[model samples]
Target: MNAYSGHTYKFTKEDNTFSYIKVHIKTQIGVKNLTRQEAVKLAGEDPDYLVDDLFNAIENGNYPVWNVFVQVMSPEQAEKYKWNIFDMTKVWPHKDFPLRQIGRLTLNRNPQNYFTDIEQAAFSPSTMVPGWAPSADPMLQARMFSYPDAARYRLGVNYQQLPTNRASVPVYCPFERDGFMNFSDNYGADPNYVGSTLLPTTFKTTKQGRTFSTLTEHEKWAGEVSSFTTEIGHQDFEQAAGLWAVLGRDPGHQDRFIGNIADHLSSVTYPRLRVMVYELFSRVNKDLGARIQTATEALIA
Candidate 1:
């Protein structure tokens, strides 16, 4: 059972030597949860509770950080993997592909201007430099197109011109000339298209002679995209069941999950939707679905 928005990406080197990779960020502090009662109390008493907690920690020099991880399945591995590597919902089990910690991202510095710095900053997967690339997760592939389209609309075509979103190094784009708020001398005398003597482009080459112009059949997936459907059976429930088993290992997590879901599901007046959710859960574990259904019905009544 796989659940992923299939998006395609390529990871390339200076000589255009590349591999396919999917990236994940895990919080160093691990996941934390608060009860509904605690959340309500915090909301009524101190709406800025989370922000305050974060600020206090940083100010006291207890910086929060995240562990950067990548689930790197090579082209060969991707072809023979049990589950679809492109599926987002299906996680690459750490047992098989253990995490390789590349670096830490610390939130040590707070922004001086929340608007110009944080609010106006445009983050897009497409903004990645040469080394990092997107994977063949459909959702990720779609975001590559959607994100920049949004940035262009929301912050203008020259959104990259904004100080917060601008790259540290200079960016050249002869084609991106004459948009709203156009201030740059748009590539002075460079040619926009290829085969121009005005500005000839030379690509970097590796010692082994691999150049940027080379393309492999495996890299492109044979041009036209294909759509295929698969049957979902026990494999789909395996992960959810494993999650339930782990929750059982913890004395109260299963109850907590049921209670949390019930609290929100009770507000949804549509009975059929509630039944559908329970039916979906029942496929994973009969007891869990029953427990959640009972709790949710009681809440509604």
Candidate 2:
């Protein structure tokens, strides 16, 4: 997820001059893994096992926590950064930009009602507040619009009116007058469209090039800040190489990554798909490519 925000994010000090940053969250207990065999068995026999484990832990006052840390890169550094910071698959190497401890995240409370609180809950990327904004990552930008559009369609236009989705503070809206299932007095007949003389709206000064007014400035900011999709380059593999090295630090992780990928590749059955997968991985690294090909062939055979 931190890979999605690789742009040099802003950091302000006492004097107000700022630098850019990226954040990483390392769980205190470290990452846990399940073997392919174990995962398959669990999925068939106990699909909710993981959820039960989390709930039981919190109920017993054993909260799982993650140490949040950030990597700082100045605007000057970002301008001259080797790889495009907007790419989601790439990470800012920790050696170049070190982690600075910021805070901790704890899963303390479970939802009271799964349907009302969890199932129906809307998690829009546009939900972000000020000081914390979205970067130019294309995937992130897409999610900002896509997630809420899904929620509004799935949960109705007044989905935000749900007890779980409702804002804690008084949410004032002059434009959202009515919809299919509106319940908020329809904004007392204020024109849903602009040019209303009764309740004059105050529009914020937005980033240049945006034409959509219904969306918040933050949503517009996300689109303006990102890079367009284009051709791939060697730099894409650089961070993957570093990640492969990190995966090697753990026993059997590198093997598992290969075997796991091979297991899926075997399911493809098509010779062309297998060849494409092999070629792609080979481009990532020669050893990974060869191993994946070997493992995949063995599985298929």
Candidate 3:
């Protein structure tokens, strides 16, 4: 499967100038998909099919590789773009902003210890390098806060101190000390207060008089500053309709998709709820919605 960074991120310079970018990781082996029937069979017979496949490939030295590309959008371009750059649901068209190859990622080795390496592993979008930063995407902003909070809850307050999650570079934040399972030196007699000249600690300083990029006047005025509400409109179904049109280009794809939807939808006992589901898809495509309703009713009958 092709991996995409749905959220836009900023690539900042030491001077605080930044470019917004979306990352794409395309598999070198190409994309392959199984039919619904095949997927169902494999799900029952070999529930761990995908994980086992990757592990075996790495064990046998047949490493899987993915080519990484980034679509960079300058701040000026972002301001004038047709679509909002910070919208997570929208994508920057390649025709307008082509992909630039940055690097390759290879799965060369498997985890030695599942519990220590895999189970204890904590992943958060907030755990980024100096040059990388998050954009104003609503979902991304929420995830940046929520994911780290989840990791703290799951692995304890000192989760960052765990071997698997610890940063390779030395971190010296004396303020964050003496939590449960804290096995570090605990900053050894250094005063926990900031700007303590008595201990003489060195901290990274930002470039003198370098101003970071700020939101434009239009962005600040246009962006919402209220609680999220479930407001539906015609524009909400535009992307789904586009995807349905794409599936139409592939032979039997649309039919299979409808069949898959019908199968699950038939299981819903509440008639009113089933009608609501059909209505939601109808907003995407009228014909597809009708087909799904027919197929689902036949199955239920």
Candidate 4:
């Protein structure tokens, strides 16, 4: 299966400039999908079929690898783009930005202890290195805070101290201390704030003499606070309609797409709800809405 970082991010420079980016992780072995019928059958037979397949493949020395590529768009290009660059619904078309191969990921080892390795694992967009950071996409901004906060609630506040989640690079933040399940000595009685004359802290600086502050100039743009609204319109469905057209290239894929939706839409049990769904699809394409309605009605009948 292929993976994408749907959210927009930034590849930043020490000068506080950045290029907006999206990540793609494509499997070396081409994507293959089981039909809905086959998927349903396999799900009932063995729920862990995919996981077992992956584990056995790795164990048998067939390490599955994914080539990591990034699509980068300059701020000027972003400004001139037809669609909102920050909109997660929209994608930077290949012809416009193009993919650049950067790295590869290989799943070579299975977990030694599932509990320590998998269960305790935590991830957040806010956990970024020096050169890479998140864009100001509203959804991305919300996720940066929400994901870590959720982990803190589920695991103890000191969940980051866990071996699986701990940062590989040394981090010193004396201000943040005395949390639940704290592994460290809570900074060992150091002053609990930055710029303390008693215990001065060193801030990493780039060769350009810019201190490594989380706040970038792009983020700290000179602007007064203002209310914003993301109003949905016909433009919102343009990319979805484009995807539907792309599916037309593959035989039965479009029909399967409609059937997949119809299966669930037919089970909604509310006429108004089903009608709303059809109307939503109508925004994408009139034919798609009619096709879905007919298929779903047939299934119900």
- Give me the candidate number with maximum TM-score: 4
The clash tally of candidate 4 reads 0
Assess the local accuracy of residue 69 in candidate 1 as a C-alpha lDDT between 0 and 100: 62
Candidate 1 Cα errors over 4 Å, as ranges? 1-10, 13-18, 189-195, 202-216, 220-231
* Residue pairs clashing, model 2: 9-21, 136-225, 136-226
TM-score: the better of candidates 1 and 4: 4
| Estimated TM-score for each candidate | 0.84, 0.80, 0.85, 0.89
Candidate 1, residues 1-301, lDDT tens digits: the string is 1112134456666555566565566787877877788999999999998888888888889998887765555667767777766665666776877767666778897778879998888988777664565654667767889999998988899888888988897665555776779677766665657465665555432334445433444645523232335776888888888778889987788998999999999999889999999998999999999999999999998
Q: Please, what are the lDDT tens digits per residue for candidate 2 over residues 224-258?
A: 54555577777667778778888899789999999
Query: What lDDT does each candidate get?
Result: 0.72, 0.72, 0.83, 0.84
Which sequence of candidate numbers ranks them by TM-score, best first?
A: 4, 3, 1, 2
The superposed Cα distance between candidate 4 and the true structure at residue 150, in angstroms, equals 1.2
User: What is the C-alpha lDDT profile of model 3 across 1-301, one tens digit per residue?
Assistant: 8999999888877655778899999999998888778989999999899999999999999999999999999878877786667777677878889999999999999999989999999999978766677777777889999999999899999999888999998876777888899888988886768675666544542345443433333345235531343777787677789889989997988999999999999999999999998998999999988999999999999
lDDT value for candidate 1? 0.72
Candidate 4 local distance difference test against the native: 0.84
